[model samples]
Target: MHEVVAVRATIPGMTTTVDPRTVFETSGADLDAARAVFEQAYEASGFLPERTERVFGYRFRTVGDQTMSFRSTRFDARMVGEVDSGDQVSVSWVTDGGGVLDVGRDELGLSPGRPVVFPTGRPYRFELADVRQSVVQLDRTFLERIAAEAYGTEPGTLVFDHTAAPGVEAVRAWNHQVQEASRIVLGNAPVSVLALADTARRTALALLTTFPHRITARQVPLPTGATGRVRSAVEYMHAAAHTPITTTDVAEHVGLSVRGLQQAFQRQIGVAPNALLRGIRLDRVRDELRAGTPTDTTVASVAVRWGFAHLGRFSAAYARRFLEYPRDTLHG
Candidate 1:
């Protein structure tokens, strides 16, 4: 059971009066004014949109609270939402122009007039300009129930590959109808709208269970001896992403001399171990920045965590590589 509440009440401890013109405008010099209205509306609804006209998508919103929100121009943009890894998921219909979605690692592409599901706990980035999309989140338990009922038993993992699946059209049509009904429920008795939402949720589960796009299973043949040892070392590095690891440590773990490890990494992974380590460090830094770590987690701390002792040089190198101030990124 879900509760669907009208999103019109003043946010707790915040003022409700805000300008819609600022929140929803075609385009103009009035953008700054619009931005103010947008900010206020976002805060009131608990979903803030940091949008550029060129990229008309909103991001980082919470369910029910509305952490992000947006609307766009006449023409729209098409995008896909995916549930790659998470406990819960929901499908949404509507995509195009200036809409943003968090799709994680699944390379699922959504054309216009398609419905997509975005599962929780996966990292995804989607960008589209000048469009609008209705957002929906699915209940994980509900989906699993449908999956068991439809497909004998649900696997530990399931893939919805749109290209391979034949039932995408049906799911799309069903999503459109659900979205329409949602609008009506939202406008009418908003308090009891949960009944309609629950129906949509159940329908979505049934549709997804039959969704076309089952990913083809591929076999990864394992290598023998030296090659396998080298592969294990590389895998270890990736798995220990947050730790400050060293090449000597890696070589010892893989039962190889330091020089041998260096040779193997260069020959196979095409990069030196230290260079690969730096790449991983840089990736970790980006991830930390995106996840909204504490402001006190400064650039210096980031560098030190990655094994860079010199603050000045580390900042310079980071700027040259990422094209932005390290401090700005850390704080932002």
Candidate 2:
């Protein structure tokens, strides 16, 4: 039997209230019924136990664009299938019990504090015994946008190095962040839109930093010419102008040493990379302020969104470039 509850969940950092459709309890002792229920609830494709008597409990909730779910099962089952993540990334952590997950030629042991990060298109096989877990799902486009703003490029593939052992401190910190995020998603805490966006951005950055990906590697080299290198760097700056990135990050992205990149910029662009980045960020801030409405949007928020942290400096730069105060532009 499954019980559905219509309850409003207060999302932390959201100004508006959201009513989430929740599945509070779902359980069945029969194998086929259990399999059908699981598939309907999670859209999971797999073969479950046919004869063994098992117990299952599931709870699911959604907040804005994200979903949080928990599942507990006390039976031996083989999940030889996949969840259609459909342009979303799913992160699951084992809160209790353990399991074995096999993806292609690799097999991972799922235990407490161990996280599995994967994009939605891959197929996985799992053998579970009395396992309980929590899962968090975020839109792929949202994360990609954040990555482009932060890294100046879109990630190629969201693949985690499951084979690599995470450090103790890193694992602990990641677990803490995940726990807090889960609480906000699952609990009834009133959240504002600004706060939600901030949390999502922080979570995406943390995931990118903690996980290993092909794009994050420093193996790719830029084109074999000064003009090409300078153009590439400039393009990256334009894409990531809204992010708080340093010149060193730009240099590293184009596969050049910091000093080499600086020299190239001087020779080709006649200005430093950091200066160009600042100019682009300033333009972005002006554009946003111009487009934003006076009631909901503020000059400080727009400036901060475009990576301008110091209000005084940001205002001075805006006045010098646009010949008007940012507040005037926003109001106008």
Candidate 3:
């Protein structure tokens, strides 16, 4: 696949980078048309099925520079192709539908919420139908540096042995992050360079830790605790309530497995970590509503500011926690 070329201006002071962040979409019954679009977006080349193919939809939105970019693609029909064997690593998550990827004698079945990394320099053939996927593409060199520093695995030997999301907990976290990224990249809001960089780092870290890699076996499992780490986990939740986080992150922060953290919370605090986190967020929202006047703060704004995107759930949770509506607190 060819890198996107920048248009040079003859009038001076118009030279720019290759491809700026943009949303590209197209649809029709043309076979080659779809192939070309996907080829430019994903460095994959192959013929589309010549059967009764109806190209219902295909779209991709890209953000960031060549070092890393987050993209989302929607394929409404079957498309079989192979990627260029290059140094670009794609950590992909299938949000909907399913597909089969065959790479170097290994065949993988893709499903919703599961992330798989198509490592650099591997040419893989894919047969995907009606799939909506988000991909984080980064250079292999960047990943190698991260691997060497954090995982103690040298170049070429830091193999991502598995393509699974580890468990249900990891699936939830993965979906949340991928969907969040999709929203940002696809949305109309301007994405600053720093924001895109943060997104790339977070996505890379999640990809590395969620997928089983060669360093996994070398690292010894930290002992689990139910009592000692519960307070620490609670503190972490309270501190990071405004940010996007998961139970797995809390467990990792406290050197415990998710089950271990849950057991500890149950034993010491009489509630699970997630429940306590929700309560803490609810309290923060309530306090904000109480402190601000109705003209200064709206229930919706306050709720969303604290990462409560679903107004229905936020309202329900607020009522359960405070025995009164959030609006009441704002006006009272």
Candidate 4:
């Protein structure tokens, strides 16, 4: 049976390091112990073994709220495994070994140089042989916050399409970013909270751009009539107000031409699409300024965070809306 022979070590800067050596036999007990190690690192599921009497090794490290893991087996053995990711998305790259992953209705071949993206709340199965891979687990809340900031709306049910492999250039870029993030999080260099936040935001944005998802406005169906179209467009704008999107993007998203979308909004919402977008962004900025700490955050930072580029205009609009200056709200 596999035995826990090592103690978990916690390093400075929120890092956890663990190296667990497991002995596998012909019994089910060893299998359970092996599965426990996987569960502790990522998600838990069944591991069906095709051979016996092998040693399994696992090395895990966590840095700045991200979990990284390396897993390998001593002997060549065919195995079937499944995992339910719960609320965390896992990005895995096969460093030295290869396998096949069955996600949803698609079976994808996993090999060196090809990275796999696993969305949260999805079940995936794998048939592995001598698999040695590194996995990074990103929290769902963190990703959703980044998405909301980028798209100007609450992103519901973020999905990653894993049916096909991403492009080579994209994979290389992501690998570079992942390595840089790891270095920043694990290295001895001092990192500020804002710097780390920026890195995380960039990484999350890159992932979203590289992978296709269901968050686009085009995926949303327009209602049966013009009023329905207007409603959909406004809802999309309100949700995406924080994003740097144009009226054209909004119109295309709701399946309308620019003129059509404008006419619909003017008739139904009594405001143009651009006006609605600006108003929503202003509201978001005001809310953040009111809720943020003045010591750690500034009015300019709050305005910039919500996509208000012109400081003078933003300040004037803030005063007009709340009957007080943005600085006053932040200080209070």
Best by lDDT: 3
Q: What is the lDDT of candidate 4?
A: 0.63
Residue 295 local lDDT, model 2: 91
Predict model 3's lDDT versus the native: 0.66
RMSD to native, candidate 3:
21.5
What tens digits encode model 4's per-residue C-alpha lDDT throughout 151-190? 8886554667776567778887888887877666555555
Model 3 misplaced stretches (Cα beyond 4 Å): 1-23, 51-55, 152-157, 162-165, 180-184, 215-332
Candidate 3, residues 1-332: lDDT per residue as tens digits? 12243321121243442223544445554556667878876644554753324446566556556657677777677878766425466777787877887644577888886777764333457778888887777765576567776765554324565444476776677667766766655445555556666676666676666676663222111124322355456656766878878898888776568997888788875788888777878888888988999777899998988889999988988888888989988988
User: Which pairs of residues have clashing backbones in candidate 3?
Assistant: 226-264
Ranking by lDDT: 3, 4, 2, 1
RMSD of each: 18.5, 17.4, 21.5, 16.3
Best model number under TM-score: 2
Per-residue lDDT over 224-276 for candidate 1, one digit per residue giving the tens place of the 0 to 100 score:
33233455565556667567678888877665679978887777656777776
TM-score of candidate 2 versus the correct structure, residues matched by position = 0.52
Q: Per-residue error at 87 for model 1, in Å?
A: 3.5
Candidate 4 residues lying further than 4 Å off, grouped into runs, are 1-32, 50-58, 66-78, 188-195, 216-332
How do all the candidates rank in terms of TM-score, highest first? 2, 3, 4, 1
Kindly indicate the candidate among 3 and 4 with the higher lDDT.
3
**Deviation (Å) of 54 in candidate 3:** 5.3
| Superposition TM-score, candidate 3 onto the true structure | 0.51
Give TM-scores for every candidate, taking all chains together and pairing residue i with residue i.
0.37, 0.52, 0.51, 0.51
